[model samples]
Target: MSEFLNVNEIKEKVSLLNLLNKLGFAAQKVSGSEHFFLSMLREEYTASLCVNDKLGVWYDHGAAGVSGIKSGSIIDFGLAYWYPASFPEVLKKIVEYAGVPLEKSHDIPAVYAERKTALKSSTYQINSISETITNPAINAYLNMRGIGSVAAGHLYELHYSILDSKNKSRNYFASGWPNENGGWEVRNKYFKGCLGHKGMSFLQGAANRLAVFEGFYDFMSWKVENPKDPASTLILNSLSFLQSAKARAKQFASIEIYFDHDRAGMLGSEEFAADVAGSVDCAFKYEGFKDYNEKLTAGLSASKKSLDKPMIFSAENGFGR
Candidate 1:
């Protein structure tokens, strides 16, 4: 007979923070008891997923589970993270990744309480925004994603500081771009977040046509490939802005979507197509890859490997000859 698993027991044993770290996600920002992270559940440029370590709960401001619940316990996170996996499987994976033995009693450490009290009041402040991208680290990050050349005009160098209640401050830098509301969608290799109000990034072009992408990097990748295509562009920044993008997309005669090939992206593309009359689902152009950036990087890698090799996107697939 198999050992029966108690959901409550598992929740108590696992550390959500540790589990997230193990899953390759670290808190990009923290305020009081809330820790913010780039939503692993979806492609988002901002940290919409906020986890309250003290309460041992998390919520994705960008999206909700199939049940429409946006916030829940670690068990809920496990269920959503390993969607379609059996309950037992999710529990097992959570335990394995969290590295918590079932038989042991896991207690919340004193450090958490101390840190919470120390950072009870904190604020993230934007120190400066540069019109040019000059940081070697940010440039390298952009280059690694195959967008260094094109990212210059589209992104900015942002210097920001996080100050806790104790008056201690830590300054950081990232490459960023602005959304419609003047908020900065910032990104470094290790972090993804927004500096102010969260919204979409739009670039004006021809009135009749528009191209939509899930994130800025995907838009940059598309720009790298089609430098002269004059379609007006919108980077949804986060799929949370899908409805808003759809509303704006209706103004154009044609719309092209370049969302990821994942489930959320597929559904979002379908939703956009159904809602907007002339929208085209261009994700098929990079079908086997996660997103346009990934496909672009793969092609870049392949080119470095063999110059004569054909690029990943060819004329027949609607990527333009």
Candidate 2:
């Protein structure tokens, strides 16, 4: 019998890199394979942090001090793991996530554990983020986009914290990965595989068109572009998830992958296409944008901004002629 793990089932043993990989992140390649750092940092590319799914030990090409440890501490510290109330009710959240028999949920006691933190001597609060998000820095970020104070405050409440992922308390923001119905944004939470339902039905009958991208955000961008003739979109959250999406592609008469124009995106898409050539009728390809988000950042049509941001256009690196 397979022993099921609850939210409290010794997460330290849960291999952090493996879990992060499951959640759709890869080793930051910007460091040129020198150290196994999370790809969350804004950089070009780095695969130094390779996950031996079985062992979970990470090594960098150059950065020496980091030895691979089981990911429990990493999850707790990297993701700001506290008691349930701080975020959503984590017990319910985990049960909804793990799907390991909800009846057994009450048996787990640690979910009720209270977190105690030492007060900081700086201008920021450690966890009571409901207050700290309104500072000038955060507000300035919100103001440029014309986000309402209340909505910005809400997003801040969830993501407005200084997370110390690689050691320094860097102020960061994050959100979602909470449900099976994918959204524009989600957190890296799925540990074993895709967090939600794995198998999606192909569009049968005359409409055999296909669409695939790295995630929901890109999917939405395509939808916005071809509202009348957009094909079904697939979410390849990370290259690792591409395998699962490949399996799902079999159901479609034809499939098209809109992977990023970057190296990893092309590699992952091409690999998937090669593997599924026998099953899928047609596996299309398109990689001209960094992502649909990048397309949106590029102002989509020389005149559009992310919806929440009131600015109709932006000057992101790739945007504008």
Best by TM-score: 1
Q: Give the TM-score (vs. native) of candidate 1.
A: 0.60
lDDT computed for candidate 2? 0.41
The sequence of per-residue lDDT tens digits that candidate 2 reaches over residues 58-160 is 4333331111111223323232222212222433444443333533333333432322121121112234335345445545543333332323212332342
Looking at candidate 2, the ten consecutive residues that score lowest on lDDT are 116-125
- Name the candidate that leads on lDDT: 1
lDDT values for all models: 0.78, 0.41
lDDT of 2 at 97: 37
lDDT of 1: 0.78
Tens digit per residue, CA lDDT, model 1, 1-321: 455456677777687988987765667689999998877555565678999988999999985532233567887787566643445666778988888878533343464334334322344678898988888999989998999989868999999986644668889999999987546788999988766445689999999999999999999999999999999999988776676688889999999999999877897899899989999999988889999999999988887768655557666785432
Q: How many pairs of residues collide in each model?
A: 0, 14
RMSD (Å) of each candidate, 1 decimal: 15.9, 12.3
